[model samples]
Target: MPKILPLFAKALTDSWRSTLGWAVGLTAACMLYLPLYPSIGGSAQMQDLINALPPEMTKALNYDQIASGPGYTQATMFGLLGFLLMSMASIGWGAAAVAGDEESGLLELTLAHSVTRAQVVLERALAMVVRIAFLSVLVFLVVLGLNGPSQLGIDVGHLTGAVLLFAALALFSGTAALFAGALTGRKMYAVAAGAAVAVLGYVFNAVGRQSPDVEWLLNLSPYHWAYGNSPVANGADWGAVAGLFGISAAFIVLGSLALRQRDVGV
Candidate 1:
């Protein structure tokens, strides 16, 4: 086993509540995608709900790309609901992974071993990946079981893409945690910073959706790219996905470099 696995295991074990909480929350939110099932397509009540939603709200929900309803229910889920789940899961996991350790003074002892700081960060990142994957699979299974064959296939595909998208998001959030761990050495501050990034990203996406003139600003926020280019609506913009990964990798490198220079327990 990797030397870092123990650290990651301990981290996850120590903060099982956050992991479990996000799992439950994301699963519940994903159920909101059930409306995309083909069985519901013909329902008058569901159609009315789609129609009644405001134009700006629908756009924020990415209703234009739905394969059924006025648009796909899964698409609406991706635009807003999916992001909310991801932000909570990824940010919370990131916090527990790094800053949480540092704040507790465990990082100093953990780093005293032969293990490198890079290994610590990399392993924590891996733990986040595993946790998010489990939640994603649970959500996909529930979505598949709830929807019919035709709509089920589409919903599953969209949800799969969203899982990958949020995995990338978790990586990005981990970088922020790494930065915070190396910067203030405070877990709470790290979590707050990550949450700030999420909120700002959400606000930017909301404003950009309301006005085309502000749309260019959307490019600045990672959520905008993921939310706007959802596979359900925009059919998976590989370019944007690549860009997100690239930015995430850059941040990861930045945090690693910062860790190398800083003294632990600062």
Candidate 2:
């Protein structure tokens, strides 16, 4: 057999169980929430109820488009639950990839072999990318399978755009954690950094939506980059997609360079 990149292979092998769990849990979440859209969002009574709710509440929760099929899926799954699940899983993996391993002294052992520090950082980052992509694909399949049954009415092309952008957003958070870990060699710091990115992005997007004056805040948010135009309904914004991928790539490069300069397990 050809010799593969050992670190990358090992990372994937070590993470299979947790990755599987995330896939299953997220799939279940999608199934549970999607099937109810017809009864709630598709109902005239529910539309009335939604209209009766305060405008502020609707804006904050992004329910402005909840009465439609694409809007319902965007609101319930991609916007809320899917975002939470993907962010948490990606952040944990990114932080643990380097900082967690170093803390446990496994990184030191790995580096003792023929692996260069740059390889270690880059390969770990690759593992994270793969895992996030895997989960995103799983989500797409689940949603696609239920699209007809649940009457989501999302365009196939648009749904693909939504999932890709969603995955990029999650990857962006994970890379933040990865960068923090490489810079500080501390898992706690990595986790904090990653969580901060997700939370602050969300807050900025939410507050920006509240008024025209503060809408500029959306320019600073990754959440805005992903759902600013409601990709599920409007289709993919390639510019925003490029921005996400660019930022993520930048993080990986910076993190790898920083890791190269640090002494592991010190």
Candidate 3:
């Protein structure tokens, strides 16, 4: 007979509602935004209006290319709303994976079973990966479904690259929270860590766009690694994608080790 990962199953079962809510919310956001793109984006007057906005404002919002199909999709859907939704979902799951369970005394109970501490941590992380992957695929399908109607001329290859990069970026933030939670066993700490990574990465990328002296800062920002070159219009930056995934994998390994070495519910 084959063995099942009980902790992974439990994690999914316990958090299915939150996962469903995030999926539904992401779908709704994608549907609403993509449908509106044609009406607003297809208008020359609207392009002029966007062009008239302050350069700093456009750069900050990654809105410099809202006049075209791929650009519109990137600026509104992937760069703005989709980014916000995925980040929130990933961060919440990461925090809850370890720190929330520990805080609630559930970690202790789960560990009292036959499972090793490594299994608990790794399974929880795996569950998070699965949930994030599901949401990413949902985003890809929703966007692809609306591509023609919305006049988004993004090639399938570029679209796939954008989706993959976006998912990796979100996972990186989640793993930051996961690492913090495993190290500290505190939910608040995990939340703070994840939020810090997301917010700082975004700010650095935005600011770097405005100043050449600070442009190098973008190298340190995950937001830049994901969307710096406008993956929706361009294509995947394979190096950046690799960096994001590598960093995330490193965090998971460190977090798992930390969890194994520490006492639960302490």
TM agreement with the true structure for every prediction: 0.81, 0.98, 0.97
Which runs in model 3 stand beyond 4 Å of their true positions?
A: 1-3
lDDT (Cα, tens digit) per residue for candidate 1, span 186-213? 7787788777777777777777878879
TM-score of candidate 3 relative to the true fold: 0.97
Whole-structure CA lDDT of model 3: 0.90
Question: Considering only N, C-alpha and C atoms within 3 Å, which residue pairs clash in candidate 1?
Answer: 66-71, 66-72
Candidate 2 is scored at a TM of 0.98
- Candidate 1 lDDT at 164 equals 63
**Which candidate should be chosen as best, given TM-score against the real structure?**
2
User: Which runs of model 1 end up more than 4 angstroms from their true locations?
Assistant: 1-4, 12-17, 32-54, 61-71, 149-159
Against the reference, the lDDT scores of all candidates come to 0.66, 0.92, 0.90
Q: Tens digit of lDDT per residue, candidate 3, span 1-266?
A: 53698788888998899999999999998898888877887688887887899999989988788878888888888888888889999999999998999999988877887888777778989999999999999999999999988888889999999999989999999999999999999999999999889989999998999879999989888998899889999999999889999999999999989998887897
lDDT of residue 116 for candidate 3: 82
Number of clashing residue pairs in every model? Answer: 2, 0, 0
lDDT of 2 by residue, 131-237 (tens): 99999999999999999999989899999999999999999999999999988999999999999999899889889999999999999999988998999998989
lDDT for residue 87 in candidate 3, whole number 0-100: 91
Clashing pairs in 3: none
Q: Name the top lDDT candidate.
A: 2
